[model samples]
Target: MFEVGFWELALVGVVALVVFGPERLPRVARETALWVRKARTMMASVKEEINHELDLQDLKQSLLEQKKLPNTATDNLNQNILRRRQATEILAEQFEPGEAAPEKEPHD
Candidate 1:
């Protein structure tokens, strides 16, 4: 996002060299690079978590709307069964074998 020209970078380098001297400049630069990398990774994780929370809110809103629909008892029962089956299938798709599944209640 920074639009630093070659001259600006050269100026920064000159200043750094004068302030740190030849002996400590390389170590300072290495530490600066590590800090920049860690900041970038932390920002990415924060963005990902925010997006996940927004998606979860959207899903909850849609589920509430689904339950508010006017329908007969038979239609409501069928829709709930269908919804549960869809949820189970979604969970199954995310798992590798048995690693991701939750225990289900036994249906008689």
Candidate 2:
């Protein structure tokens, strides 16, 4: 930003008065103020839009991460279930069709 001090502002005002003249200076200054106000409003609107879009991006990213976590968890659960089923099948194979499985020894 430009660091315009009080003297610089006075100098610019004197120049503007000389250039624009007394009759047109007030109108010109008013119009300039209006344009500056409009520019500030437009900049604020654009800044708000950018922040909103960034928030949405963050939300979407978090949702995607959450979605991935559940899928990974589900996949792990399925894999564990499959492993257990395989172990159960192996155990079943150790017993004949009509034979009972051996009783397990209790842990101390």
Candidate 3:
């Protein structure tokens, strides 16, 4: 995202060399690179999570709109079943195999 030219990078390198000296510059650069990589990875993960949440919200909104419209008993029952199936699938995706899922309570 930065528009740093070759000269700008060279300038920064020169300053870092002068400040950190030859003895410690390599280690400093390595640590800085590691931190940048970690930050980039974390940012990517956050972006993925946000997109997933938005998709779920869209699905919920559409389901609500569908319920608001006039529909027969069969349609409503089918929609309820579909919603439960979708929700269970979503939950299953979040857990690894061998992990315990939360126990469901009796509805009535």
Candidate 4:
């Protein structure tokens, strides 16, 4: 990402060794690696949080759509009443001998 090459890295290492000395250089390197690992873990956690929020948003949208369905409680009750009335009419017709079946009840 930094466009750093092998020669550049070697030069930096030589400079670090000269400035910080060998003993301190190893300690500094270890600390730098620790910070890098921590940064990566934090980034991963942030990404997961974002994805989780997105999933929640999608679920909310689907729930909103479901709420907009045409088959509401009143509609379902009306449909049930209509079906029952039809069934009763069909049954009455079957037993009417030669006469026609009665009219169905009004839903309202």
Candidate 5:
């Protein structure tokens, strides 16, 4: 940003008045203000669009991380179930028809 002090602004106003003359200066100043307003509007819209895109990217990354966690948990749960089933089968094979089943520690 240019640091235009009060004196510099006064100097520019004086020069503009001289160049544009009393009859045209007000119209020229009004048009310049309009253009500056439009430029600010365009810049604000661009900034908003960039912020929205950044938010979307963050959401996508979170969704992917969430997806991975559920899949891992499901895989671990399936493995645990398989281990328990195998332990039950082994115990069945060791027990005779009329004999009481021996107690064993649960599978890890």
Candidate 6:
């Protein structure tokens, strides 16, 4: 993000070495590394949480669509079943006493 090139980094290192001296430079570098690592980990965790929330919203929308379809399908199925049952009763009444039962076939 800083977009620092090799020359910039070399200049910063030279300045740091002169200002902090060899004795404190390594300790400062170590502390800086630790802080950067912590910041990156925190940022990653935040990103993951945001993504999880977005996924949950998408899942909720999918479930809502699925929920509507099933209700409509169930209502249609109930109407169809009622109509078939009425037709079956009418057919049964028309049959003669000794007539065979209606053929039972499974269809999809």
CA lDDT of every candidate: 0.93, 0.96, 0.94, 0.91, 0.96, 0.96
Residue-wise lDDT of candidate 2 within 62-103, one digit each (tens)? 999999998999999999999999999998899868998789
Where does candidate 3 clash, by residue pair? none
Q: How well does each candidate superpose onto the true structure, as a TM-score?
A: 0.63, 0.85, 0.62, 0.57, 0.70, 0.62
TM-score of 5: 0.70
lDDT of 6 by residue, 36-67 (tens): 99999999999999999999999999999999
Leading candidate by TM-score: 2
- Put down candidate 3 lDDT per residue, 62-100, tens digits, no spaces: 998888675667789999999999999988898868988
Worst 10 residues of 4 by lDDT: 65-74
What is the lDDT for 7 in model 1? 98
Better of 4 and 6 by TM-score: 6
| Count of residue pairs whose backbone atoms collide, per candidate | 0, 0, 0, 0, 0, 0
Question: Which model is ahead, 2 or 4, in terms of lDDT?
Answer: 2
Considering lDDT, where higher is better, how would the candidates rank from best to worst? 2, 6, 5, 3, 1, 4
- Following a full C-alpha superposition, what root-mean-square deviation does model 2 have from the true structure? 4.5
| Model number with the top lDDT | 2
> What is the total number of backbone clashes in candidate 2?
0
Residues 29-98 of candidate 5 have per-residue lDDT tens digits of: 9999999999999999999999999999999999999999999999999999999999999887888589
- Say which prediction, candidate 4 or candidate 5, comes out ahead on TM-score: 5
Q: Kindly report which residue stretches of model 2 are placed more than 4 angstroms away from their true locations once superposed.
A: 99-108
What tens-digit string does per-residue lDDT give for candidate 4 at 29-55? 999899999999999999999999999
Q: Can you list the residue pairs that collide in candidate 1?
A: none
Candidate 5 global Cα RMSD:
6.5
- In model 3, the Cα lDDT at residue 84 comes to 100
Deviation in Å, model 4, residue 102 alpha carbon? 25
Error of 5 at 96 (Å): 8.6
